[model samples]
Target: MSKPRSLDKSTKEDVSFIDRQPDQLTNQSVGQAEPEVPTGSDCAIAQQSSTQNINALPVDVLPPRLQEIINEANICLGFPKDYLAGAMLTAMAAVIGNTHTAEIMPGWKEYAILFTALVGSPGTNKSHPLSFAMQPLIDFDAEQAAIFNEAMKRYEAAMELPPKDRAAKGYDTNPIEPKRVRFTMQDVTPEAVHRILSENRRGLVLVSDELAGWFKNFNRYNNGSESEFWMSVFNHKAAMSDRKSSQSGVFIRNPFLCVIGTIQPKVLTELAAGNRNANGFMERILYVFPSVQSKVRWNRERKSPSFDIAAAWREILSRLIGIVPAVDSCGEIIPEDVPFSPEALDRLFSWQNEVTDRCNAEGSDTLTSIASKLEIYAVRFSLLLALADRACGDEKKLIDADIVERAIRLTEYFRVTAAKVQGIVSEDALTELQLAVLSELPGTFTTAEGVAIAAKCGMSERSFKRFIKDRKGVLFVHSAHGNYTKL
Candidate 1:
């Protein structure tokens, strides 16, 4: 394995920065994180201590099995909600999302498409939760690969036959083109995604353990189409890619793409300053940054849970998979539109009107977009909940008032968390600039090394020190000597 980089000679220790996960949203789900278990009394005490900021949605926000998955992951890997909740959201998106399973209201059809970002520093055990949650999907893809390869062999054999023999064998040009069987695409190009979308009428997902790179290269093609495509797909609008170079291209009348991943807080600080996400990218996401664990509890004698969390995950997903995605006579996926129950419709429209009036009163773009979409997300969340509850044997899929109530609560939780993300990322340009400098430095950097890198940004040594000094317990945790680490 390669050694971690250092800043200078004689500084033997490492200096770390950007502890939070970066802007990776699309993908399959599974993750683990450390948990700060607080009793009701402890919570009360904490609240009495100050106006406590609960940075995460409570564990109960997730479904029972999903909650169990997150809990077991925490016990095993110490992943926090910052990681696991996003993974659970991803798990929901992947299982129920691609299928035209159910919908929300009239003329407003939507799948369970959700984008989640786990915001935390590295070493907090962020990636594992997502890995654990997405393991089932990953396994399913691997299983499908064998099927795809067999089809490819048949397709190639058919292509190579003589014209008469091929006609007799019912072979056509480009026959049996390998179906778009894969689901997860990580840090890939737009054309590659277009190809996947073309073949997989069900849709595709984008997932990354580390999201910083994805956001950095998001606009790499320099074409505005990527941005436009992302915006359009958020609403399940029909889209197609017209690639040159003798490609037949791909089209999907109903495109459902879900994004989820982790991002470093420092990278996000720099990234939030850019205008890339202003065009509905960030607006569509349910951003979350659960506060770090207040204490690390280690029981040397504690035995690891023997239960198979992945198996349990697969069992739930297997049921969802049994509910086949709708397909057309042309073998394309036909989405099943779900209407709101009388009670659900009443509650949803009440929420819509309330939010519309509130946003109009507030006159905030962010709030307006958030309020509008959160209600829509509520619908999606309700459908997912109703479907899961039914498929798992509780009852048949029914969008009811109870589901709507829970959906609203979940959306409320995400709204608070997203505000926390936007507040930090959008504010403090100097801090963002400083974060950029730290990101460039080796994890452990000497004062001279830091000065040299900061100077490239037109920052003088004194100015840099002044900047770091002011950011004491806020953005940084000062280390010994001239070294520092991101908090």
Candidate 2:
């Protein structure tokens, strides 16, 4: 392959300035200063004082057999052993903090976007993980799960609920009925989303497969109020007005609900740039891109476990709901000595700065938007980590550098990979141009011939020459005859 092209003159100059004055470029840290750890006595006192009715269901009460099954199933689902521990810890934290509520409430987390995309080739069981593997963690009961499934079906059918006849006797008049509604895998409308949140108050986990398909629809309707509605729901704090009795002027807030979506990488690329969906909306999501290599294919020749692991997991998760921590709000439980190193913090901030600068320079507003989304994801992940630690009976609420490192790396991979797919950098185009020129001209060529070759490759002579020069080591003078030769 041809050598990679260097940055343009202006970009090179900017890079030089950065290299010469690294302190000037990244003088500040991205997040707040690490808090000091509390003493054991302090933690105990704090836990006793602020203890709420969060843990209605205690894990100690769970049967050992069930616990073992849960552990084994989690492993089967391909979750790393460490992450499984983290998940348990997260559940424990939620139980301790507000047993009734998950600490990472959608809007309360302060993420710019709440987006989650699962990417892999077709039939990689991508959607199954979100729907079956993770869904049960939310703890939907049989009846509630049935209702959720139906809601998805109705959503897919595009069958709007018939307008209620308020005057009819024996007809339920409740504005939001407790009906099991499943969203159509295809039709993800603003109205449908609004209804799902409004009716499913106990918290609903909306899962969709082939996200690229829905993303296309999102783009088609990404104008006017439709887009606004989508953004408002994601804001988490925003409440939707009652569609059915505006005269009553009632508004409802959805606190417990969350969305988990799965999609292929190609679909994500299309949705990220092709659609006019604001970067702000995209940034609010916790993107989990599943690896294709990790997919477990089932065939007739090979039999795998067909047990309802989701059902089992849901039971475990349901037990965690409404469990709040019994700790003081101000008291910090993390050990100060175990905090992330200054160097780790520095690296994180540097990465954030790099992402911000690149997004700004590329004029891709989504880059900055994703940065905000990533911050929320990081915080949520941290909170989960803290909760998991506390659940494991660890006294500290502070997460170590390893957790932060993993979160940052995950966010960066998604952002950088997405940006590349969208062709945000000129590197791809330049590389293609260079390859084309090399392929056509095997020997030295005059300026006129070079321009002709460039024209044939569908680029302007100016652009072609600039690429040649910017590429540096690849181009050389042939006897200074206003001709160039491949080095």
**Candidate with maximal TM-score:** 1
| Cα RMSD (angstroms) for every candidate in the order listed | 12.7, 16.4
Estimate the TM-score of every prediction: 0.73, 0.51
What is the number of backbone collisions in each predicted candidate, taken in the order shown? 42, 41
* Ten contiguous residues minimizing lDDT sum, candidate 2: 17-26
lDDT of 2 by residue, 1-487 (tens): 1111222333222211001110011101112122222222112211211111010111211233333433454335433222232233323322222122222332343321234555455554544334444444444345456776776664543324444644253333444323653211224565565555555443344445555554555544424444445556555455665444234333444333344455555455455553333445555544443222234433344323356655555555554443433433542221112244454455455655665664454333434555566655554444444343343334544444444444443344344333233332223334676667767874556778878988998879888767655532213323243655443
- Determine which window of 10 residues in candidate 1 has minimal summed lDDT: 11-20
> How does candidate 1 score on lDDT?
0.61
The residue ranges of model 1 lying beyond 4 angstroms of the native Cα positions read: 1-52, 101-104, 166-175, 293-299, 430-487
